[model samples]
Target: MIEKTRGIFLHAVKYSETSLIASIYTEHYGRQSFIINGVHGKNSTVRAAVFQPLYLLDLEIYYKAGREIHRIKNARITYPYSTIPFDIRKSTQVLFLAEVLYKCLREEETNIELFDFLYHSLTLLDLTEAGISNFHIWFLFKLTRFLGFSPSREDAERCNFFDLQTARFVSHEPLHSQFTDKHLTVLFTRLFTIDSSSIENLDYTQHERRLVLEKLLEFYHIHLGNLGEFKSLEVLKEVLK
Candidate 1:
């Protein structure tokens, strides 16, 4: 049967000489794979850009439950980003979000809230002119709610350490060193409250942000199984710096 949905294109790969395989996260369904044929043909610019990573789209999808892969019948840009691609910082930020989502989000369970949060956040990033250096920090933290492990403020403030194995704060370090008080403060004190406009004021050194982000991803790997490598991290770090 056919259904309509608004989706965020997470990743796309060249499947054949002219076709592409795209992983799109839709509000009605979840993470869905689609095959688009004839993308390399002349004047395919319109279809090409619509499938770009993290692009917001309105789609009519041909879905069949229990099928390994589905197809998209009609897709159009629900919202065209004004500056996410052109602005280098915003472009890198989009890549960062895409990479993280590609790895961490797995469940196909219906989640309208998570979809809305992601969609709104992306739109917000494009519209808001500044305060994005700390965007991923906020992004990861917000995602915890959908993952069923959102850290509590009371525990976050009281604990001396972040226990990555347990995905919460602890009074003392666990068997392995997962997180420190410094990074916890950054996550709680700054990322929770600050927006793009306020990101400039809460600025830490680029080195500090990188270290904190690296540790955060480590925490994620520890808790969320072996989501081994992030190839985009190195480039994103270089670009942000």
Candidate 2:
């Protein structure tokens, strides 16, 4: 049976001379892998271009439970990006975030809310101009809420440190190195209060932005032990610099 769903393209690798294995996160299902054939052919309906990082897609798939990889009957870009592919800053962030999502979003079941959050966020990333530097930092922090490890705001105003291991604001410095100092703790806590409407208002220098992102990734690594190092991290940092 074939089912239609919206999807976000995450990553893909060449499987053969003309075929590719792509990982996409679907709205109705979770993360799934599909073999796309004849992508290199002139008449291929689903071109390889549509599989670009974090591209929103409309898909018709042959889905079956217990299958390691499903089949895509049809796939096309849902919303063609206007700026991200053209702008290095925006494109680099998309590449880095796409890799992060591919690594951390391992759920094999439906999560409607999380799916919507991702879809809208990517759309916003392509459209928004102001505060582009802060977008990835905001996105990483917002992602924690859905991953079940959003930092605790308890005593946020009174805390001098953010304990990465515990995912909470601490009144004193943590014993371990996986924590934030008072300055970063204050910045991290502010993320919890920000929403899409106010995202443009949030500002940070390049250095400050990089520091927050590193701390955020550290927080994620502490919770998601297998996240590993990101190959795109250096490129993103270089582009943003």
Candidate 3:
């Protein structure tokens, strides 16, 4: 049977001389891998354009209960990007965030809310211009809420430090190295109150943003232990610099 669903392209790799393997996060089926054939053949009809990172696609696919890889019957872009592909800054951000999502989102079960959040957030990134530099930092914090390890804010008023390992605000610096100072704790509180309507207000210098990003990655490392050093991170840092 064929199923129609919405999906976001995560990554693709050359599988053979004439084919590619793609990982996509589908709204209905969760994370799935598919083989896209004839991508390298000159006369093939399947355009490679649909496989770009974070591309929104409408797909008709064949799925099975225990299969490691599936097949797609049809696919096309659902929302055309205005400038992500041509703009270096936007494209770099997309690539970095897509890599993060690829590493973190591995569920084989449906999560409509999570899917909706990602779809809207990516769309907003493509459309926003005022706070592009701070987009990824904002996205990183928002993503944690859905990942089930959002930082604790209840102690913010009384505490001046953020314990990364414990995911909560602390009155004193943690004994371990995995902690943030009071300044970052204050910024974390401000970030917690932001959403799409207010994301543009976030302003930070490159150095300050880099510090926050490093700390956020540390938080992720503590919670999601398998996330190795992200390959796109250094490139993103340099690009933003």
Candidate 4:
């Protein structure tokens, strides 16, 4: 049977001379893999341009439970990005965030709320002008809420240490090394209150931004199993600096 859904492209790799295997996260089915055939052929209906990372798509697919891979019957771009593909900084951010999503999200069941969050957030990133530098920070923090380990702020007022391993604040420094010092904890408190639309208000310096990004990755590592080092991190850091 064929079903229609909205999806976001995550990653793709060449499977044959004219075919590609693509991973897409969909609104009704979560993460799915599909083989797009004839992408390099002269008469291909589905162009390779529609499969870029984080691109929103409208799709008609053949889906079945227990199948290893599904086939796309039809696909079209739902929203064309105005600047994310053209601007170096925003496109780099898109790549980094796409890598993070590919690593951390692994569910087949539909999560409408999470899907909505991602769709709107990516749209916002494409539209925003002045706050692109801080967009990823807000995305990382907001994504935690969906992944079931958002940091608790109940102890924020008096706490001076952020325990990454435990996902909360502590009075004294953590005995283990998986924590931020008092200074970073203060910044973390401020970061938690910021949404994507208001990310500019955080106003972190380059040193501070790097520290926050490191801490955010640490927080993910502690909570998620087997999330290895990000290959895009080096490139993203170079681009940002």
RMSD of each: 2.4, 1.0, 1.2, 0.9
lDDT of 1 at 41: 76
- Candidate 3, residues 1-241, lDDT tens digits: the string is 7899999999999999988899999999899999888877897656687899999999988888689999887889999999889878889989999999999998988999999999999899889888888899999998998898998888887788999988989898889989889888777777877789887788878988898998999999889886987889888998898
Q: Estimate the TM-score of every prediction.
A: 0.90, 0.97, 0.96, 0.97
* Tens digit of per-residue lDDT, candidate 2, span 1-241: 8999999999999999999999999999999999999989898887888999999999999999889898898899999999999999999999999999999999989999999999999999888999888899999989999999998889898889888999888888878888999888777878877888788877977888888999999888889885888999999989887
Expressed as tens digits, the lDDT of each residue in 12-42 for candidate 4 is: 9899999999999999999999999998889
Model 1, stretches more than 4 Å misplaced? 42-46, 181-189, 195-202
Q: Which segments of model 4 are wrong by more than 4 Å?
A: none
- What candidate 3 gets wrong by more than 4 Å, as runs, is none
Clashes of each: 1, 0, 0, 0
Worst 10 residues of 3 by lDDT: 39-48
What local lDDT does model 2 show for residue 70? Answer: 89
Evaluate all candidate structures by whole-model CA lDDT and list the values in order.
0.77, 0.91, 0.89, 0.91
When 1 and 4 are scored with lDDT, the better candidate is 4
Task: Give candidate 3's error at residue 237 in angstroms.
Answer: 1.1
What lDDT is reached at residue 155 by model 4? 92
Q: Which ten residues in a row have the lowest lDDT in candidate 4?
A: 191-200
